[model samples]
Target chain A: MTDRLSSQFAFLDEIDRLKAIERATPIGDNSRPENSAEHSWHIAMYALVLADHAGPEVDISRVIKMLLLHDIVEIDAGDMPIHMAHDAEAHAAKEAAAAERLFGLLPADQAAEFRAIWTEFEAAESADAVFAKSLDRVQPLLQNLAVGGGSWIDYNVTMDQIDTRVGVKVNRGAPRIWQFVRARVAPFFSASR
Target chain B: MTDRLSSQFAFLDEIDRLKAIERATPIGDNSRPENSAEHSWHIAMYALVLADHAGPEVDISRVIKMLLLHDIVEIDAGDMPIHMAHDAEAHAAKEAAAAERLFGLLPADQAAEFRAIWTEFEAAESADAVFAKSLDRVQPLLQNLAVGGGSWIDYNVTMDQIDTRVGVKVNRGAPRIWQFVRARVAPFFSASR
Candidate 1:
């Protein structure tokens, strides 16, 4: 029991590093780039508050859990922006390894549960995972929109890139939210061009 | 429908301020004070990773939701530390008002749900809320322990104060966890004196 508790504590202590893992999107006021931990919190709150817009099959509690656990991999692999260019296979391999190492710090059962949730989120296949993935994309879009094309401008992200990279997944799970986001996002692209 | 989405977006935008609301506790390495948003996320992760230790009646999903919403009131009322001197009645009134205004920014149903969870967490009456409240106290205690008495030393906290303020509640919801924490925390207090 003592060993189990210690493993859990060590895992928690290690994850504190997620707060220092900076992402590309800034906060609403754009004072600084938001960190992964807070982005996870905001999206969990997004799951809670905007759950009504999710697909009928979605389980919100599970979606919230996935969102909270999703970016923890960023603690080890670091934040990779959606618009940034990277070797997809290498980044995925690194994230998978990071998930194992970090989640492996927990007692066996918890380590498996967290790793499964993190994996499910990466797969984005289940209804809950799909909704969770949508939210993962939704948050950064909202941040970018709030800051008048935040990372989009930073990376010279185009409308086609936004549609292919962001729109398809969010629309798959939460079409209404995607619709709302599309309307808000159009002005930014038009003004940029 | 558009109006509802706007309200929800407004609420999300407002909560970006929470990332700016600093707490008394520092991160593990003591680089800087932790913000309320990341703290909420960390504790939500704590509730997830440590649910086995909670009382049998505790539904961890509810506990996670409660933990996530609990400190959002701080976005308005601001963080008031456990050891800080303040009027209990006045602070409660302030927090109540803050909850109403902040949660009120959501669509009506979401506002009501978020407000209820926040209030339940404040009441600390239900099994889930009790566990949620316990983890809330536990995280800061761990942070303080990690930093060689992080805020406890800064505020000149004594062992008795820790027992009365932190131990009792954690023990109530999770006696085993409290026992673990007690053992880990003893050396810090003993060394300080």
Candidate 2:
């Protein structure tokens, strides 16, 4: 029954309480810490700018919608870094709960629409989601590279770990980009090895 | 000169910082926070949902673009609430400085485009800018209503103040909605007074 002007909602204050939850920042110029909002915007841009890269069958606007709403759950569950030593399963549980609470902020209709998008992003079953996920992963890697290797250095990250973290995604969205990453990093690691 | 991807750029931790910025919630649900990223998304929806109400001559997509990029500067100067006891002149100074630092994040072409949008929104001269501003103002009132008189009660906000905050925006964007707000709130306030 409620809408954008429900007048009885209690979460207004709590909504203000939410903070940007992002992974730890590293030192460097090429690197920039992306906020959840910024991350969403960037992903949306990917849908716009990289539409050609997405499978021709995918609906880019849907992918954009997915990216923009994907992280709303971090409002409650908090942000976790891709390179964290945390348990993946536990993080998933927290995010799921957060999604329910955060998206519940909207009126029933809007909430349902947003919830569906977030859920689709999580499912990653669709070609669009798959492609979006790749950009999500690849963007951070490039950011680290730009910043002269950020979290990668602090964690003593190796090429193998980077590949797993980023490779799987690129493979799904753009195998060519994945191949490019593989070709670039394997040599540096091989020489070190 | 430094550009979008800093070959030696500093602020590698910008991602987390931005996340923190985006997650920082405002006083209302419908109202866009001072964050540039969320502001973009919120405004897009406004353009769509209120398309019927928009001036016939306005480009909805252009309006959406203006909204999305309008607030990227809060990344540097931070958010200034509409009702906060702040100096309007000083805030303008702070924002100008922030715009330079924040929008400069994108590559040159993007930076120019974004800065122009931000400027246009601030100028409020264009139809898209006017409509975007209207949405910005209306969203908070809707949020306060939705959250059960949220910031309205918390701030002991007055009818005169609320009217002034949203009056022009509503009139400009959707005269009908403005009329609806006046019809709903005017009598209630007079009686309460």
Candidate 3:
């Protein structure tokens, strides 16, 4: 009974700590923030869809685990785009702050587990983490392209920038998916031209 | 590469299909619509913090998997609370509809694995599923008591009503946790009088 009651305390604490989605975009004319919850779901889909072309012998289950938890810290530190143009130091600070607040929600042992997964993802050194990162990058690229370069047009994004941001994602994670992106999505860049 | 990708898609599809968190609060509040993503994270904490009390040896790893994928269908069907006072048909219809849409998100085989985990949870037939469901029930009861009758106040819920709702939960899952709930939470009802 003591345990059951404590479980809820842990649950509620985590909920309170999840970061609010702050990315805003105009759908037609209205703008709204994309909360962390939505971002997590979208990334999971990218992981699911792109699982086939992952790096060799990848334990996708671990990749799924990492992807689900990696951004939870974003709830505390807040999200910054890869190109949000912050130096590594500030990036480290923001993610580090987020890591402490978010992981702190769990009991000591569980918090350690979650914190480890998040850290592993940040390093992007492991095969699983790298695969997960690829999906993270690819999902947003697909979203932007699907939205007809919605954010790209809004931000006046250039093709070179998009390539730099999402290109290596293909090189590292799944070469096939990257090729598809190039063939299917490259036309969009030229069409915009 | 293809096998890993397809496997993830299959699991994701199944997770999406399960109508895990369709349970809602008695009254309509946006909060009742707590996403599956939120519920999964909450339950993972339950699995982690309260693992010691579970009767069966809990594979924390497997428990985490179940918790993470449990209520995916809620993504499409939205959350439905347990005490909404709906007919059996209406309730079943709501969740069933949600299951179809949510699971459909994944490619194919991935959907089946997710669906099985969800089924295991709803059945309470498997050890892992039983522990997972126990945690699910435990988390919210604490929240309601912590917030001084949370949705209870909003919906004008009575002590008897909460007991009845929690009764089925207690009988089916963790006995120890159930006993604690009765002892600690019953006082809340008595003190209110």
Number of the predicted model whose lDDT against the real structure is largest: 1
In the order shown, the candidates' DockQ scores are 0.84, 0.17, 0.23
Q: What is the TM-score of chain B alone in each candidate?
A: 0.97, 0.78, 0.76
Each candidate: RMSD to true structure?
1.1, 6.6, 4.9
Best by TM-score: 1
lDDT of 3 by residue, B10-99 (tens): 444344322233343211123443445545655665565566677656666677677776666565555556656657677557766766
TM-score of chain B of 2: 0.78
Error of 1 at A168 (Å): 1.2
The window of 10 residues in a row where model 3 chain A has the poorest summed lDDT is: A24-33
lDDT of each: 0.91, 0.62, 0.62
Q: Model 1, range B88-118, lDDT digits (tens) per residue?
A: 9999999999988999999888888888888
True contacts kept of 3: 0.16
lDDT of 3 by residue, A96-125 (tens): 877776667556676778788888898888
Local accuracy of candidate 2 as per-residue lDDT tens digits, B35-112: 455445554555644555678888876676676556655666676667668788888898898777765655566557
Better of 1 and 2 by lDDT: 1
Write the residue-wise lDDT of candidate 2 on A1-193 in tens digits. 2235432133332433332445553322434455565556655654554455567878766776677667767777777777778988898899888877776765666667777777778888888888888877766665565456676776777887877777876898877656654665566556653
Worst 10 residues of 3 chain B by lDDT: B19-28
Each model's TM-score for chain A is: 0.97, 0.82, 0.84
